[model samples]
Target: MTQRICGQVVRVEGPAFRVRGTDGTEWHGVVRGRLKKGKRTATAPVCIGDEVEVTPLSEGQAVIERVLPRRTCLVRRTPLGGRRTHGKAPPVQVLAANVDVVVIVVPAPAVRSTVIDRFLQVASSGGVQPVLCVNKMDLVPEPAARQHVAEVVTPYIRSGIPVVLTSAATRQGVDELAALLRGNLVAFIGPSGAGKTSLLNALCPGLDLRTREVDARGRGRHTTTTSAIYDIGGALVVDTPGLREVAFALDEKDAGDPLLLFEDIAGLAARSRFQDCSHVHEPGCAVKAAVACGELDEARYREYLRLRRALERSPSD
Candidate 1:
């Protein structure tokens, strides 16, 4: 008879996963029948940081019996965008699982904040913390660009989320960022040239992680080809391939709290004459008033409105 137990997966190796139990021992195991049965909830069913039930078949090997209910899941949208839901079902894509924080990295000087906004919106929709990391600050040479970065990230910080500024080159803010991810499964996400890998190298040196130069337009070549987790002392950090696009749609069920993500809009939205006010062009919109009265940056407010629109157009009805 096999002894059944429960553990959390710290790393996913080819066919075997490194699972650590509450007792602090390690087991190399394979996914059991139940969890292997294809799940659409996440990009990868056996993602790093997943808590699973297992049965030990050997001294160092076990079979995963079940993946326990996750407290938080971090996911992204498909880049191809062929599916349609039109009030039917959500056209969502899963990226990872049980991530306490979704670290959304973005290159500096991105005028639209599209990359950052899109990731934060998804994190908000997934009930996870979106930690905005503006990487490559060392490369952003202009004062205006730096100002834009601060402006775009101010709302999230004011709302109690921590936005970290980092530069792998000078090891700037590396310790602070590492502390945030310590003891929690934090996923690093960003487009190709946002310095995700560089930051990883800074935080965990001696690994000699590969890095490529970002093009003139700030596009970086892919250095990370898969989603892998690294153990730093007692913490787990997941480094994934460079992302090109972040889907704006989320599942119809248990989608994240939009009000919480865009908390600033709540005041005006509730007071609007229309219960269904989109807040874009609605009359008597208080959200708009705040922006005009120097309460919010024009760009930041626009990004919020875009997120609200993306949510509305989401495949889930």
Candidate 2:
């Protein structure tokens, strides 16, 4: 029997994966049959940030024998809007495993609170910390642009979430962002045009992560096609393909509470007249009262409601 070594998967493309050991050695390997035969929670048996046991074969090649248990995992459903997978049940896609922090990157002047809320739900549900990074701020220095970005992200800030305004172009907030991600396994996730790759390059200098410009229709061209991991100043960063949308796979019993992200609303919920109040039509709803009385921003409350509806309609439900 060949000696087995413990390693962490840095990337997975098709059936092959790149695993890095503690000694800084790397191996290219294919998943062994046992992993394929066993039941898997996600579409891919191995994902970026997974720890596994590898068996060396010859040269630089090896075989992934076993997958270690994951402490945290960010999961989502397959892309159903674009290409059809032939009526097959959408397999769960694990974006990253064992992540300490999830960095949601959004381009300034074009940020969408709904999208950010969805990512926050995933991070919160997965039991990991989430940091919202607004990139390309330098490109949108106009007061109107600043206002738009501020309006979209203010609720999250008020809810105790850390929001970093960064500009990869001008190096604005780059150091601050890097400090936050240091000494942890951070997964960088965002929409296609959100400047994720560019930001990584800015932080690490020579990462050379590919980047592209948004089209005239305000849609970003896909720059990253696969998930990969990199080391940036001792931090393990997992970079994933650009996501056009994040569809939740939450179970009804495990659906994340949007109000939980809102400190004020969550605190008021405890005082609702009905323990099971949905906060929409029930009387004596403290949440509703707060919104009506301007104690809480109505727009923020509405976004919370929108997130709740999305979770309720999750495919897993």
Whole-model lDDT values for every prediction: 0.74, 0.85
Candidate number with greatest TM-score: 2
| Pairs that clash in candidate 2 | none
- Evaluate model 2: give its TM-score: 0.92
Could you tell me how far off, in angstroms, the CA of residue 166 lies in candidate 1 after the best superposition?
A: 1.2
Model 1 over residues 1-317: C-alpha lDDT tens digits?
A: 77789898877756678888999878888877656566554444676678888898878888888888878776665555556545544434556678888888887656346566777777877778778888878877789888877887776776677889888888778888888888988888888888888888888888667888978866788888656678764568888788787776555554433565766667657877788676678888777777789876576577676666666665443
Please write out the lDDT profile of model 2 over residues 220-259, one tens digit for every residue: 8998887888989778899998888887756456655566
Candidate with maximal lDDT? 2
Per-candidate TM-scores read 0.84, 0.92
- Tally clashes: model 2: 0
| Candidate 1 segments whose C-alpha is farther than 4 A from its true place | 38-43, 81-93, 109-112, 214-218, 253-260, 295-297
Model 1 Cα shift for residue 99 (angstroms): 2.2
Model 2 regions more than 4 Å off: 82-89, 292-295
